[model samples]
Target: MTIWMRCFTGLQEVQKEQSDKLQDMKQFLAFIKKEFVHVIRDRRTLLILFGMPIMQILIFGFALSNEIKNSKIIIVDKADDVASRELISKIDASKYFEVSNERISESEIEPAFQKGKLKIVMVIPAQFNLDLHHSGVSQIQLIADASDPNTANLLVNYVSAIVKDYQSEISVPGIIPYRILPETRMLYNPQLKSAHNFVPGVMALVLMLVCVMMTAITIVREKETGTMEVLLVSPLRPWLVMVAKAVPYLVLSWVNVTTILILSVTVLNLPFNGSLLLLFAESTLFIITCLTLGIFISIMTNSQQVAMLISLMGMLLPTLLFSGFMFPLENMPEVLQWISNIIPARWYYVIVKDIMIKGLGFASLYKETLALVVITLFFFIISIKTFKQRLA
Candidate 1:
């Protein structure tokens, strides 16, 4: 309390006696303009700044897809009967698995799975068709690369689905009387487009880059070049100096949000089921949150490089991981899920996905919005205190 009081006194008493309204305003604008020029004039950084989004869009939009196609698989069939051949044909037609090779010897299974980059190695027993016809069930062995456990599970599931479909098609009358027919309906994202997930996550990353990285870098730049001291010593209040520093970035970060929204809708066919105004407003809050975070980091570090390292390591990984942007929170261990609650981007992602995909209103998003607000206020207040402490 005393620290803040003394800071306020210095800011008020020192600036008030020497304050000139017109000149101060002019100096603020000039400061902002200089920031703009710094961004525009740096050819390498300018290219990277704009190029990053374009590259991200192109890579995530066109190249990445959730639907797995033509997974490599090897089959070891002891029974090369008509039923076995038909099952193999059905699996091939499903487009999810491609039979790269087949072998009768069980010895070939391990080698094929290891060298062939096979997703699954399936072995059909001798008299598999005869056993299915007489006994109503045929046993098979499936070996999969469990290194990527999720993909391995998916591959097995795909194969299971294909086998079931084939089984239903060839079932004799009265042979499969007891059956539980299951129907699935996917809402919001019926097709389960990868973009439906990636866009929001990428947007979170982009917002982080724009606000946190940029603010931290710029603030540290001024500090490194000794201009931060100059600004603090000037007639302008120190808080006002920081505000001027953030203004240009706030404007540019908004531009980033708008541009991304437009591209997402126009090019990638992004679903905007809720109010655009709400989305932008929430994004604004998140950006401010990141900006405040940047200010906090700047106060702790002396150099731009240090700030960059801190931002990348501290916020970026946590945002990507803890935000459910990559791995799901529900699927994570309970302790990890609890820890994810503190990452600001987790709340932002829920807000973005709700508005963009689920079409939920502010009524559903109040908690998430409140969380972001709380985090932002926490960081903002701390950064302000730090700034005042440094100025004093």
Candidate 2:
């Protein structure tokens, strides 16, 4: 207790007094304006600041996922009989396989398989049904592409399940009744690949944190270093200077997004399954919302370190936790789930994932997209009011 008191007393004695109120206030604004101009000049920081969100989105969309689906198959039926026809019908009925090719000649099989046109090929011998009826056995060969284990396994299951169903229905009762089950198509990730499901959400969270932290720290740094005072005395309005500070970062962020997207598709082999334009549009709005959040953090913290800490701890935590990054919103407690409603990253994740992974159009994303826009507007209005109040 004595040691604690001594430390506290020494810290209080060493603390520097604040500058004169009116003069310092004016100088702070000038510094912010000058720092804003320097921010405009440094293009790389600008790019990372602005383009970070898009890069994160692409990284998350393409790099990570939990489900895989939609394998391709080929049918080569020599029998072309009723029983063989019944078997083919069953295979076609399954949603997991796309009938990408059909082959009759033995030579065509090598060519089609070599070209990667088929993941599996089903062959029904000419006398398959005749032999089954008489000998109680039929020969059907399933040639699977062994290169991709996941697709091959799923393809085998689908083909086997379909044929078993047909055999059971025609077989004597109490033996093994087989019936065609209802097709269970995956609504979002039809292919069921893990990358498509996770990348979108990952992208949202990464971009939000990077963009917000970069903007908030940069702004606060100006105030800490005494540059904000020079800019306030210049002719520019506070809002104009703020916008000027923010715009370059926004443009650079978009560029970074493009680079990340190229890497996602070319390097990571992830699919771009939605409108690029809509993706960019929503991304721009989301970036703006994040920048506003940074501005708010800057308003509260005089030190760049504090601004960075605030952005990371305050913004990143809520964005990751409430935005459904680690936990499913549906599975969360009602209170936490409801709280997620206000999280910008959560809304952006839904928008990006729904549009990019699900291939959903504007109509499908309207509600979520609108919520993001509304949130951005709310932040902008609040920050503007707060900034004005600080000046007054």
- Which candidate gets the maximum TM-score versus the true structure? 1
lDDT of 2 by residue, 1-392 (tens): 99999999877765532334555567556645665577768788767655665555555554543333456677788897889888776766676666654555655776777887578888888987898887878888888887988667767877887787787776766544564547678775566565654566656665676568877877777788887777677765677667656665576557656765666667556778889998998888888888888888887788988888888888888887888856779989899888999999898888878777667788888888888889888888888888889878
On residues 264-363, what C-alpha lDDT tens digit does candidate 1 reach at each position? 8999998889999999999989988888898889888999999999999999999989999678899999999998988999999989999999999999
TM-score (C-alpha, index-matched) for candidate 1 = 0.86
| Superposed Cα deviation of residue 262, candidate 1 (Å) | 4.0
Candidate 1: what lDDT?
0.84
Q: Could you estimate the TM-score for every candidate? A: 0.86, 0.60
What C-alpha RMSD separates each model from the true structure? 7.3, 14.6
The TM-score, computed over Cα atoms with residue i paired to residue i, of candidate 2 is 0.60
Candidate 1 residue 334 C-alpha distance from true site, Å: 4.0
